[model samples]
Target chain A: MNHVTDLPLWVAWLVAAFLFIGAGLTLTGSFGLYRLSSFYDRIHAPTLGTSWGTAAIVLASIIYFSALQSRPVFHEILIGIFVTITTPVTFMLLGRAALYRDRSENNPEVPAMDLPKDILDKLKLADKTESVYLESGERE
Target chain B: MSATILLWAITFAQIMLAIAMVLALARMIKGPRAQDRVLGLDTLYVNSMLLILVFGIRTGNTLYFEVSLIIGILGFVATVALAKFLMRGEVIE
Candidate 1:
């Protein structure tokens, strides 16, 4: 009673293969999410799943459906595009939030913050010292 | 013959996705901090979206694809709002 029943054996096998590969990549990415230690590290892990992982699965879906229906189907592209654009934005915001929290807490893991006043004062003193040396050199 | 094989493969994939979902849920429940929990939630959303997609493949229906899309959008918005809240204590400020 199924439509795919009428499709050729090779076509069905190809669709299955694509689905498996996509699902495997997604599983690997999520597994990395569990295995990774820090938030930043974990952030990179999901990208694997979001980027190519979603692509493969969506491609598989498109191929399978189009072949089965004997027509082009592309609605899955919407999900693919949505995931691609949103993943980076979410990761960046999360990374920035983590950085802000760490800096506020004065966590030793991050580099020291550059203070504006300290740099400006150092620059002024350096300029004065340079001018004094230049005047002395001119006299000599 | 091929239909049977395809069914078996799809079932296998479904099982794998279910396990992945469980792992994400474990992370969500076992978080040591708020941000960890948020990260876990985000991961869970992605896993669930994929799960729905796999279901669509198995059932040979396009309807589940729409659901997956909705889930993706909602997950993105939810994670973004949570991340913003993490930066400042308020979602809107």
Candidate 2:
């Protein structure tokens, strides 16, 4: 509580700068999620927050705590590491799931799997319709 | 002056994060597809976690970090499960 006043001027400024940067990036990512037109396009937006936004804020926290407590306090790194490891796994799984769902439904907009002809034949997926991407000459 | 600046910055960051959470919620509610909803939910989770961390900093307490960490873990698991369910139409298959 009162630690805010106890913090040195330089530390306070540094923390404030990081707070603005992290919060701004997170807000930008969320806006992209709300505004993007397609699921595929939207998938890339959250990473801005998940990666650097979280990092900058966590860095600020580390600096704040270490400055106040007079010790190296980095337990926040646990959140950082856990998030870094898990976000890609979740997003990749979600992306693959979305792709599979779209492909199985024969959605014309999604690209066909780019596999070798022999592999496609062996998998019995060779008869799938060609993707209508550039053929339509207009992006969705 | 420094204390006032830090205090105001923390307040502003919290407000911004809360707004981000609301925007994510809007996407979740307005999604045109299941995957979009799931993605929005994921973004919501991240925003809330960041908000919690900021709260911890404001109060000078490390306990909120653990809570935020737990939230991240649970959110990741929930998202993965939902994605699995979407992919195969089943969660445990």
Candidate 3:
């Protein structure tokens, strides 16, 4: 640890508070991951940590460094942005892969991959109605 | 006055994160399937990165920031690779 005299009291306290909040959010998210039942449900849990959880900590870092250096140090935004974009993509891919494997194995836990023909026809009709409603909403 | 309060809060936060990591590790070790293990690993990586950020705040150093960033990238790649392997039974397929 650096000597205590290096930082002003207020700045130290501010950074510490930010760090605490960020870590708390992260812990909650991870805890959710463990508590949630089923793989698909677990998938949503990490997003809590990846999105706002990562953002809060990065913001804390930016705030701390900028305050200490007396200038804006905003490069930490890169990791924040990278994570925000990549985490969703990874989660989506993993979910899809799991779904595929489950379907291939004919796992009863997962729904059938291809809907019955009647259901597909009904879905198409529903989609058409949805599109028409969307267009009407846009016009209004 | 407030500084002492903030210090106590941060210490509490670190303790929470440590507990979270342990929970994740337990899931990783107890997983019944390969995918579950991979998911645990992913969670572990994200938690560790956040832990590093907290340490950076404690030490007031920008260097730890870089380390955290690198760990994030590495973890992302490793998880993706493992997920791919799970899908195809090979890393490069």
Candidate 4:
């Protein structure tokens, strides 16, 4: 707590503001996760936290540490970069997985496959609205 | 004073993050599908990581930076693996 006073007033204010915004966004995101009606809708919620929610807090951290240490501490950038690069990969994978599962179960809400009719017949999926094509690829 | 303001702000932020984590947990527990649960778990990992970073800022310690970074990496790996498992019915196959 003693070290808290060593921070200048303006820096303190800036950090506080960033903290509030970041935390608020994160809370909203999580609340969305809890309240969303479907898996696909819920999937979009956490990105709010992973994106700007993380950026705000990391920015605040960079500011606080840089001010406290009297030098530009930039190591926090690694977390930012790693998160930015990895988030899309995870989200894409999750979405694809969900889509695959839904199609396998013959779910009607998901979009239809775009393959030509010949391929759909060869795969024994001509009667189905969507497919388990990816599953067939795996089996073969 | 600025110190008091920052302290209260940090405290409030931490509390909010904790609540966010709980909300995520609720989703995980109430999920009707495995994908929903995995999504909630991913959100939980992210919220927990941010909470750790805020904790670092409060203590003025740089070590927590490494800890949070590791948490992020682990979360990414865990989510990816879980997603793969969902897709293939096996993580390594």
Candidate 5:
């Protein structure tokens, strides 16, 4: 903060804007997690923070430090990139885990593992319509 | 003019980030389900990391940046472990 006063007016404003943007996104995302009604829906909320939220903050840091020191500082980029890559992995794993648990419990609320037993049973070998609407995108 | 603006902006941003952490913590505590709690905890980790970065900007220090990086790593690992346990009832199976 000592060197902050030494910065050019425009640079200071720029740093401030980025920091506010980053922090705002993060706060809103967390808030969404709190207000969302369903667990599945809530999972998507944090991605906003992890992605652009992290980006904006690190951007501000990079700008402030580079301006103060008069040289580009690239270390902050590591945090940005790391968060981007790992966040999706965690979310995905968590989603799959949640799905697996729900499926195993035979929760009537969740989709069945094999396309609704009653519907599957009704379809006979003689029907032969679409096989499975998603079979590698190859048309008949 | 911009000097004071910069200071206030950083302060405001820090407060926002801190509020975010509190909201995440609330969700973590109020979670009706295990997965919900895990999601909240993950969000908490991320918000806290961002808060640290804002601190980095405030004090003009590289040390805070490094600390944020470490927190990011820890958050990811912790979430992954918790998710794995939730899926299979075991952290390392």
Candidate 6:
């Protein structure tokens, strides 16, 4: 509150801009979280916030504080790094968990683990082709 | 001129983040299933962390940075454990 004015002309504007963008992205992600139709679709929503949203705000903080205090304030980068790394892990695990739950419950809407006939046929064809290539090489 | 703009911007940002948190809360409470609830909780955690960071910026305190970082760590651990629980009936096995 007291120190915000101490920031120079350009720094103030930069910080303000970054903060606004970050907040907007986060809000939009939450809206997606609320509006999306399915759990799987909803899983993709928060990534907007965790990715650029976190990065923008942290960048603003770094710029504002580093300039204000006359030294680089870099610890915020640690948070950015941590968020970027962990978000994927959590989301992946959550998605897999939901899929496992759905499969266990025998939910018909979910496609069976067994591939469709077309894909299975393609794989079988490929297997046969590989065996034929091996036999041809042996004959040569 | 810029000071007032900056103040207004900070206030605006805070309001937006608060709205995001509320939306996340709504999803968490209105969940059709456990996974949705867990996802909502995760989003809520991230929104709150952002809110705290904004608060830190408003007050010009570095301490909020540390607080936000800790919140991030806790949220990740919590989400992972909850997700694991969802996958298996038990956690840690």
Winner on TM-score between 3 and 4 is 4
lDDT values of the candidates? 0.82, 0.91, 0.80, 0.93, 0.88, 0.92
Better of 1 and 3 by TM-score: 1
lDDT of 2 by residue, A26-113 (tens): 9999998988888999999989999999999999999999998989998998888999999999999999999999999999999987
User: lDDT-based ranking, best first?
Assistant: 4, 6, 2, 5, 1, 3
> What is candidate 5's CA lDDT for residue B7?
86
Candidate 3 vs candidate 6: which has greater DockQ? 6
Instruction: Name the fnat for model 3.
Output: 0.53
Q: Residue B5 in model 1: shift from native, Å?
A: 2.4
Write candidate 4's Cα lDDT for A1-140 as tens digits. 68877789999999999999999999999999999898889898999999989999999999999999999999998888898899999999999999999999999999976798788687676346345766666689
On a 0 to 1 TM-score scale, where does candidate 6 land against the true structure?
A: 0.88
Better of 4 and 5 by TM-score: 4
The sequence of per-residue lDDT tens digits that candidate 3 reaches over residues A6-121 is 55777767766667777777788778778888888888887878888888888877876787688999988988998888897777778887888888899999988778899889
Residue A55 of model 6: what lDDT? 94
Candidate 6: clashing pairs of residues: A1-B58
For B28-93, candidate 3 gives per-residue lDDT tens digits of 887867777788888899888888877776676778889989999998899888888878888884
Give the number of the best model, judged by lDDT.
4
Model 2 misplaced stretches (Cα beyond 4 Å): A121-140
The TM-scores of all predictions, comma-separated, are: 0.86, 0.90, 0.82, 0.90, 0.88, 0.88
The RMSD of every model to the true structure, in order and in angstroms, is 6.6, 7.9, 8.7, 4.8, 6.4, 6.2
Measured with C-alpha atoms, the lDDT of residue A87 in candidate 1 is 95
Q: Which sections of candidate 1 miss by over 4 Å? A: A114-140
Better of 2 and 5 by lDDT: 2
Where in model 3 is the C-alpha error above 4 Å? Answer: A1-13, A115-140, B1-6
Q: Candidate 5 chain A, which ten residues in sequence have the lowest lDDT sum?
A: A125-134
DockQ comparisons of all candidates to the true complex: 0.54, 0.84, 0.42, 0.89, 0.75, 0.70
lDDT of 2 at A40: 94
